[model samples]
Target: MDVFIFQLSEFAQLVFETTWLPLVIWTVISFGVWFFLQMFENVHPIYQYHTRLALIFSLPAGLLSLASIHYISDWITASAGDGLTMITVISPIDISFTQVEESSGIPFMVIVQSLAVAIFFSGMIFFLIRFCMHAINLKKLRKSLNYRPISEMTSLSPENRGLALATGKNVQVAFLNSEIIPVTFGFRKPVILLPDTLKSQPEKLNLALRHELTHITQHDFFSHLMVILTEAVFWFHPLVHRLKRELVEYREMRCDNIVLSEASVSRKEYASLLLELIPMPNLNKELSVNMAQESSNLKKRITMITQQSKTKPIPKQTSLILLGVIFISTALAMACTDMQTQNVFDEEELDLMTNIDKTGEQGFHEIIIYMSEEEQAERHESKLEQLRMLEPEHIESVHVWKGD
Candidate 1:
């Protein structure tokens, strides 16, 4: 169990350090862009595409990002140490740059400055490309959709009547006033507009209006928006996509729960209303309205509603214990698995060892040797004898070398 926990912790740490942070940042940025786009434009195809793209690219990009950090750190350290010092003969791999008050020819500062400038320029170019796509999509959405105030409608229209019945919360609904195609707009105020034909059915209109209103009252639209944004940001993560899908399904379920709670209508009646309002083939693709699409989830939603009475509740203590276990397990898994500090050496010892100039041109480098009892017995040599091997005449100097 300990070993398993340790391994799990290491894996968690690696994920957090490499993928999780990057994915989180990417999700935030992607969601921010999507939110802004939704405010101005109908959901852009590019936004969806970008979300999928981000999920696809997240893992590789995360690994690369981590690698880059290590590389940059090494590069920075190396570049900081330009040639102010001469090469004292030591290991062929060992190279050190020393600081001199005055030195000529390509200082470490210049090298680091050049590299920093290049990185900055590269980042700017990437940002420009990203911004351009967002700008283009926003421009197109503005052309397609026109915003109107929610309070303009005096009576509930057939299109919005269903929404009014479904939600108890006070909300406004509106539609984009466009002859080309109707787009649904939602936010603090939501709207659903219909063509002249759809407004005639009083019963169907009530059901449809109730459905849309349920979306607003339960904040289904916003929950979906959050999921979509999350999906976009985590485009590189399969788990994120799965989670987003689950979140959407849950949102629908919650909305259904609300509808069931308020209406007192039989399950069959509600289901029948949903089926009756299935728009014609031509109206299927309209973006403004949430539809009873996704047949698989629809069945599940119906089943859940039918079985709502059988739902069981777990004890509070059990829930708390489960949460605590998960938290502790996750923390332990991360701690044991972290690679960075796994082989940590004393920094002072490492610095002293690395900086030691072994060649005689610098000075005689003293190495203090400590031995285990077994090692001392195996060697079986006095300190004097060891000193004599280097220089017999310097034997007396050994005691002098020791501090008082």
Candidate 2:
């Protein structure tokens, strides 16, 4: 239960001081890929299949983040350390902008660690809310549906069923008695759900199935699932949105291309179908495609279909080149996972600091205090004041380990 409630990134950072570094590595990978790809005006067809290509290039970032949890910093005792002189500065938080020296790593760590934790928890919470909402919506919608058969489909069903069959999944087409727009739902035994409005205008059936079956062939439901998870994980990052938008548009275009390839389907009719469905209610189920429901992109999608935009099959060499670039860049970023950190302090300053222990019995501290059960049970707001009221002799020593 705690796993679902509390933030995990804090515990991860506590164990590995440099655990936040992986997020930096990921930001670089995401941004660099997006920037370079955006600069190319005519991206080859290999990359125009952007949905798969983007995930292939970007998902390894998760592995890098997972590896960061294990990054441990080994500490060395100030007395045993050599050469470095003690020049005590203020605490990390008090560090001024003028303190440009690389020796003051505290300020840098403070800012980076805080930002990383903030982003991590924020994204997690956002993703959780969205996930739960989708779950509830899917359950409600699925219950409202009554089972139906492929044999009962309209005249347009045969060609669409043939296309679905080519994907080698036994497809079921059903009538969803809801105001929700056309969608392809389910997995394993997938169902393409058409709004009952379609039952009246049977001619619209071919256009709808061709579009939905094209989605089936493209395996779009799985892709939507993957992107949503990625969005939840990388919610605070800008590139996550960019990647999402890119994937959504490209997958839809790819389906349009597939459907338009059929001689029987006319470009004007396909565009008309999109225009027809835009005003209806929209629905996005987890792992489902709501065809013609996106109002903002409706015009753009219609244009793409009507224009019959065509591109050449990418030469094998170009694909290899792009793949190699992404591979090398990702590998370099992953290597940063092993970066080590250490806390360094001057030996001379340490001697003056622990002057109370000349006998060297315990170099760190000579006094200790234990809180009474009643005191421990006090509210946290009053506990500190209670501790302050205690005399110096009763003060506690909180020994922090600086192990090497």
Candidate 3:
């Protein structure tokens, strides 16, 4: 269990270090561009795409670049000549659970460092538990809902055929008892769940139906899960919310664009349907995108629909340039990150450390000797002989490494 917790903490630390810098860079770059372009119009749609791209790609890029950095660093450290052997250190871990020895006085800075690590692991564990709970609730929600075949809904106008054409696959429709949220669910056999109240209102139902279908066509559910997992993993970071907000806002806008492009559906009618479905006080599902949302988000959706911009997507060449710049910059940022301390000890070295009688020159020599991987195999044989022969004052100058 100790090993398990130690490994879990290490994984959390790896992801935390990997993500924060890239997340910050993504936020700054996205916000900077948003500010620059919005000097023309405050709600310029371009930021939506900028936000989308940043949220979508930055973390994965950061993770990849971070991994590359560790690999390269290891190779460089290992390939160093005979003068510098790759050493195995047994310093205090960032997420250390064991009490520090009385001889090693814990410093103020070490307390803060350890506290930060505790908070990180705590946040990751908390979100992981929350994610599982939501998953179980979603499972029950699916079972409780009544499902019907798409064929049963013949009231759909012929105009909806365009919407059907939009979804190349057959989609199932389900009815829920509560929640006005019309959302898309499932990836293989995609289903859209609507409020049972929409049954009598075919026109409004058709609008809602087409909107959900558009989400299915785009495979928004997977992206929704990806963003949720990202947020869950990095719940401690403030900018994650900004990235998530961009992702959610742009997703709806892009879907709205697709839904509008398919037919002659008036923007006003679409906006009205959205207003009609405004959620009462909460949302109940996860891993799904719904038609109705909170009022503030709804306002943005309405604005985008009513005054939908003529701005085109960032051009492919331009997008490539931007992506390339982010890629290089992210790699460079990972390079600048400070090297992390690692502690790996064999049983023999552990025995040396646990020796409570160890003090002064003899104890210190055993510790440094263990640090040199090449000399670790010698154990204490040569060191014991040298310790017995030499006086403490006769020893050469020692290099004492300061550890946090």
| lDDT by candidate, in order shown | 0.44, 0.59, 0.62
Which tens-of-lDDT digit does each residue in 83-175 have in candidate 1?
Answer: 222111121132233454564645454455455444545655654555456446534654564544433444455445444544543454334
User: Could you say which candidate leads in TM-score?
Assistant: 3
Judging by lDDT against the true structure, name the best candidate: 3
Expressed as tens digits, the lDDT of each residue in 51-169 for candidate 3 is 45554456565667667877987787667644454444353113223566675544454455456777877888888788778768767877886787675678877766666666777
- Any runs in candidate 1 off by more than 4 Å, and if so which? 1-93, 96-184, 193-198, 263-266, 277-289, 303-404
Lowest summed lDDT window (length 10), candidate 3: 338-347
Return the lDDT, model 1, position 316.
Answer: 30
RMSD (CA, Å), each prediction: 15.3, 13.3, 9.2
The regions of model 2 sitting more than 4 angstroms off are 1-21, 40-46, 49-119, 151-154, 177-179, 285-287, 309-332, 339-404
lDDT of candidate model 1 versus the reference = 0.44
Provide the lDDT at 43 for model 2: 62
